[model samples]
Target chain A: MNNSIMILIFIISTVAGYKLIKDVPSLLHTPLMSGMNAFSGITVVGAILTTASAAALHSKILGAIAIILAMINVVGGFYITDRMLGKFKSGLKDK
Target chain B: MELNIVNIVSLVIILICAADIKLMSSPKTALVGNRIGALSMLAAILFVLIYNDIITIPLLLVSLIIGAFIGILFTYKTGGVKIPQLVALFNGFGGGASLIVSFILLLEQGSNIDTFARFTAFSGAIVGGLTFSGSLIAAGKLEGIINQKPVTIKAHSMITSLLLIILLAIMIFGTVIDDYIVTFASGATVLSLLFGVIFAIRIGGADMPITISLLNSCSGLAASVCGFAVGDIILISLGAIVGASGLILTQIMCKAMNRSLWHILTGSTYRKVIDSSTETIVEIKSDGAKKEVHNYLEIVNKAKNIIIVPGYGMALSQAQEQVKLLFDYLIGKGKDVRFAIHPVAGRMPGHMNVLLAEVDIPYEYLCDIDTINPEFASTDVVIVVGACDVINPEAITAQGTPIYGMPILRVHEAKHVIVCNKDTKPGYSGVENSLYNKSNVTLLLGNAADTLAELISQLQNDLQSDTVLQD
Candidate 1:
């Protein structure tokens, strides 16, 4: 959780992600994007921490809104991605 | 030792996510991969709840349930044609969440917050606010709620630059001065949101793929910076991964269109709208047109191999079902049929494939431009359904046009070409489609759904009579 370690983790994860996504064919780019959208919702963790540690009522209310939004992002993104990937069927096998 | 335990657990979760992405590379395993990803998210949330001891927070639990319900409802109601808009909308939600978190941290941290945390909080606010507003505009445009054409006021570029400079100044002031963090941070947030509007307003619909990808990156970057503000490693690593994936997709879309990302972001490629009268409409079934359709029909009946090229126009007309019918009909007749999808064919990357798949067209029949380009020469007929720029020979032949040097499907190389489009007007680039003038091409201009239906019925009648005659 140190600043230097956080920066190091970011760099490593970014590079690994860049290499990993390169293998996904263009055929699934839309689903790939939506799935990443879900991951970005990891902000909900920060939202919870911020809300819990807040000293004032208004700040807690704002943090709760953030939690709701991020939850929507995580749940909706993954669910829709699953829906899309499910739709992709092999024609040869189906026949 | 407790911190080590936390770090080890976080690393395990990150590994799970990485494996999930690896599984997404193939269709067969992507469904399981997505489920695994959802599970990983759930685990991360539960881990945070237990570690932070926030499980007793009634408001958080209520909010989660409400958010989950809304999310599921929205996704369930969204049809295939509207997937891009839905993605953009949800992406905006993620950005907005980061912005709110950053705002809360900035306001509540007081004297104990370090300079690095304060700086990252400000940075997160800026990026998050911009992504939130920018993505909403993008979603609106995609949904037809806002003008799809670029809306530019006088000195648009100059105004955008001024807003950006102000936001940067406010961010710096909030970070360095610290005395008026509340006031300066609020100013920066508003200005950043304004900048998002200015940034997205001048981008036309055709440039949406790049804009969406770029905004996707900004949302992730925003979350990562928020993690830096809070010193959370899980948010940092996951956000970085999403950011990198978005950047890669942006680069791919830019390369496919032969446009630099900078030009797109700066709206350098945008020009004033041209007059609609300049578009030439070659009506269907005129004396000369009749003869061309007849020739195209004769060629289609005998053609052994066919490739169907679909564009955004196909989506606009909602003709995917009709296209499916044609595909089925052609395949039934023993013709080797394939669909050629240009990288930027629809509003986003791989949009055409998703649309085709929604109608039960198999993934095997969908081929990217690179894979289908070489086969066009040997193809007996190329059928263009509601597409223009991707198949326009002007992309390769003409110089100084907007589409010059951009990759096309090489539909012209086929022995015969049948174009079923709304009109002979130029595509999003406004460069004339030289393919329309080619000798071997036949234009059937109308609603793509109607034109395709006519083509199918014509083929059905012709082929049916031919079989009867042979019998």
Candidate 2:
């Protein structure tokens, strides 16, 4: 993707995400923040591609470390969010 | 862009994640939404491996396994109270990943890289570096490893401004003249880290929710810019989405506190030490402690409609379980009880809700401030558990105070008030609570858990004595 196209995608997705996330209740804001925090780990894709494409060993090593950190962020963020969301239960049977 | 397998797969995964966020609107579907998100992440990783034919890379597999193991271990051990710090730590990791990736790109591509990619990489490095360090400092504060009080060095504003100017110069000049790109990126990374520490260190405990949310946005912003450098749609779009979500949460927290984002970022958060000598001591004397407890119990027993307002101190003292027991006891006695949660109550947004939920308090009974404020007027009693600033009547009455004009729960509107706090001290904002001075207010100062325990026991003893008398 070219720079302009990439920038366009970013703008469109940001607007879409802002709209979608607005509907989330304040009750679930913590989990929502953690969930999005996990998604930020999508940088793992960059780490993987860059590491695989790099010619030098040091560059590859740095990419691998990035991959590790990003993966931890992804896994840990989702895990904690799920745990927290599971606890949000209503006592009343209906609604 | 041409339609290809990779593009199709990336689009599908992005949609899945979007649907996941959409499902989060309601808690009922949020669990499944989170699962779908994780699965989509898995799919994204798998696709990247197959598309690149790097599935056989031992280093990649090992790194992933190690990362997942550490992630699970940390998440498993982390309890509800530590969620804020854990999230901050994890956010730091994400930001660090972005910073490292951007640095790698700069080193490998050198001057040969296109100007746009170079610029994006530089921007990513700066944002990612700061996000990484800022988040770590925030986590430390939340974890109690670092002082929760704001620590501003001499000439803090001047130093911060100078650093900002230097970072801008490196970013702009490096893109134009790529010969010293590596040196510039390294310098920017170091300076950004320093700036982040300075920025975060000066923010006090009560302002954590805002700081965390902003750092969360920076992490995403870093990832998105790195995506532009690498020219990948998934990184760009998903990162942007995360970035926007964080920004929205930050705005919500700021508005809830009635403070501006700029004011918080510029280190205008409360640092005043309230002068206790001049302030009137409305707190009940120690000699009258027994009478105060008796008075609180009698009023609590007679109250039919009750509201509990919990704050960060409740979490600090691990009193939620005791609060839960109190809730159960009240419910058994047929009292209408609900929790009034301030938007900025705990260390993070929705933090109080999660803590209450952990103790099995029904989400239905937990009401936001706006929803519960008017009801306070009709309430028979308001029990404040380790909260101050949120319920401080001074927010409405006082001008020029740090908490002035801030939105607060109308605890004073209730007929009677009982505050179970550690002391009569002002809260994080350093503004004395005027509610404690009201005639209807009963200050039950001590550890919240202990105070609630004694209150429950007193109520129980009264019930036993009444039955004995009737028999």
Candidate 3:
């Protein structure tokens, strides 16, 4: 794909996301923020690519660190958000 | 064929994003939605690894296992009360990861990288650096490791502008000069990191939620640039979704506080020392006219319908358990009871809801400002538990107040009000709550847990005696 076309797609997708998320009640803002945090961990792709392509010792080390950090963001963010959402019981049963 | 597969994966990821957004709107399915979002992210990661044939199996497995183990441990061990700080730290990690990825990308490309790729890498580096450092400071403030007050450096705006200009000049010169590109990139990274700290530290505790959301957006923006640099469609789409959602969250937070983004950034919305001093005088005058009820138990027992407003103070005191006991007792007594939650209550967005939810407060019993505000008028008693600003009548009554025009719980509309707080000190915004001085208001001065415990014991004794008399 051309770089400009990719940029255009990025802008359109972002605007669409903005519209979709605009009406989220304040009750769920924390979850939304944390969910997005997990989503941002898509950088793990770049980290993996960098690690695989690394030719130098420095690049390898950096790649390793990036992968770990991004994974942590992804895993921790989702788990914590789930813990939070789990607490929002419908007043029916003790979970 | 490879391009077609990537395109299909990107479309699937976008569909996942849409599903997550829709699921997040409702409480019951939100958890499933969160899980689905996580699974999709995992699929994207696997797709990238497999399609690119970047199969350094040992290295990838080791790093992922270590990271996942630590993440699981951290998330599981940390109590719900510390969630805000945890979220902040996770955001910092995301930012740091993006920064590291961009740095490595830049190094690998060297001078042979295309201008577009170079520009994207530079942006990714700068934004990621800012998000990483800024989120750390935000976590510190929330944890009380750093001062919660806004730290004003004289001429901060001018200094920030100057630093930005210098960074731009370096980037431009580095691109043009080629030979000094590495040096310039390193310099820009350092400057960006400094800018993040400076920008974040000046925001008051009251505005921390908005700041966190903004930093989250920056991290997402950084990841999007990283995607562009690497030519990954899934990363780009996921990054854009997070970036856009985070930006909207920031706007929502600003709206909740009744302030513009610019006002928050320039640090003008924070109440200054002079303004606080003037506020003290107004508080004294209001205090003189107010009648403080000493017989809190008597008033509470007499009230038929009651509402409890929880805020940051409640979280600080860890009073949610006692609050639950009180609610149960009130319900047993046949009183109509409900909890009113402010949008920007506590240190982060949805902080109060999470706190109450942790204590098993039913979702139906918890009400937002709009739903609960009208009920306040018909309510016999209103308990302001460790909350000051959200219940402040000044938001509507007093013009020119720092918190003016902000939507509040309208607790003053109740026939009687009981304020349970540690002291008469103003709230996070440093603005005095005039609601404290109303004639119907009673100040219950003590820690929220202790005060609530006393109330619970008193109620329990009364119930026991009544049962004994009937027997």
Candidate 4:
């Protein structure tokens, strides 16, 4: 994608996101923060590509570390968020 | 030219993400909504992997396995009290990953990278580095490894401004300088990381929730810029969504505290003045001098209506389960019971609610400040379990105080207030709670879980004795 087009998409998506999250109650803010943290882990794509295609050893090492960190962010973030959200029950029986 | 299938799929995934976030607002569908969000992330990853055809299967599989294993183990092993720290750590990891990736991309492209790409990569590196180090400091503070009080040095703003100017100069002149791309990028990263530490350490423990939200937004902004550097549409869209939502959440948190974002960012919100008079009152309670021991069981037994206020200390002592038992016992005795939750009561947003929900407390019994504050005046008794600032009446009664104008639960309005904490020590704000000095408030000092357990057994024994007398 061209740079200008990408910037346009960024602005539009951000506005859409702001509208979507406007009504979230304070009770769910923790889960929302963690869930969004996981989504930002999309950097794993850049990590994988960089690591796999690196022509030098140092570059490869940096890429590997990046991949590990990104994966951790993605996996841990989503799982913890799920665990937190699962605790919220409408009735007492689920507990 | 025909549209690529991957682009279409990416658009669909972004739409799914938007819907998922919207559904997460309600408790009933929050779990499902979170799962769908995760699935959308997975789909985006797969799209990128297949479309780019960058298949180093062995390396990919190994990294994924190790990362997933560690992530799962850490998340499950961490207790509820440490969830805030864990979230902070994970957020830092995300930022660190983007920082590394952007730096590697920049090094590879060298001077051949376009101006726009270079700018995005540089911004990503700087923001990612700041978020990475800043969040680590936040986690350290929450974990008690670092001091919770704000640490400031003279002329800190001057130093920060100087660093900013140097970073901007490097970025602008990098293209003109021969083979200075690596040096300039590294310099920018280091300077930003230093700024992150300065920025985070200046905010006290009381403002951590808002700080965490801001850092979460920073990581999202960094990731989105990385997407621009790498030319990935899915990454760009997801990152933007996270960035924008996190910013909105930060604003909401600021409003909850009745503080401005600028006030928080400038690190001027934490007041250093300690009211000496309030300290003397706390000393009287803790030193057992003229200590009036009001029997909590006796008072609770006679009360027709009761309210329980839980806070971060409740989570610290793992008292929610015991609190639940007490709630059930009170209801069994035909007493009116409800929970009053302050919006910023816990370390993170909804911390107390999550703790109570874990122990099977029904959702309907939990009430926000607006809903439950009006009832406090008519309530027979208010039992505050490990909460301090939220119930501290100084927020309304005292002017020129740090917490003034911040809406509280109005626990002091009840006919009687029973405060349960380990000690009369000040709360996160480092100021003594003026509510403790009120004549109607009685102090019960002990671990929250232990005190609540004792209260429950006492109530049960009282009930059995009453039955014996009747028989």
Which docking class does model 2 fall in?
Answer: high
Q: What CA RMSD would candidate 4 show?
A: 3.0
Count of clashing pairs, candidate 1: 0
Point out the worst 10-residue segment of candidate 2 chain B by lDDT.
Answer: B284-293
Model 4, C-alpha of A59: deviation from truth (Å): 1.5
Spell out the clash pairs found in candidate 4.
none
**Alpha carbon lDDT at B443, candidate 2:** 81
Model 3 residue runs over 4 Å out of place are A92-95, B1-3, B174-177, B269-271, B274-289, B294-296, B462-471
Q: Ranking under DockQ, best-scoring first? A: 2, 1, 3, 4
Best candidate per lDDT, number?
2
The digit string of per-residue lDDT tens for model 2 on A1-95 reads 77787888899999999999999888899999999999999999899888888889999999989999999999999999999999999799842
Expressed as tens digits, the lDDT of each residue in A1-95 for candidate 1 is 56788889999999999999999999999999999999999999899889889889999899889999999999999999999998898998755
Worst ten in a row by lDDT for model 3 chain B: B278-287
- The sequence of per-residue lDDT tens digits that candidate 2 reaches over residues B308-394 is 999988998999999999999999999999999999999998999999999988899999877998899999999999999899999
Residues B190-242, model 4: lDDT tens digits: 98889889888887776888889999999899899999988877778889988
Q: How accurate is candidate 3 locally (lDDT)?
A: 0.83
DockQ values of all predictions: 0.82, 0.85, 0.73, 0.71
- Candidate 4's C-alpha runs over 4 A off are A92-95, B175-179, B269-271, B274-281, B284-298, B465-471
lDDT of 1 at B34: 93
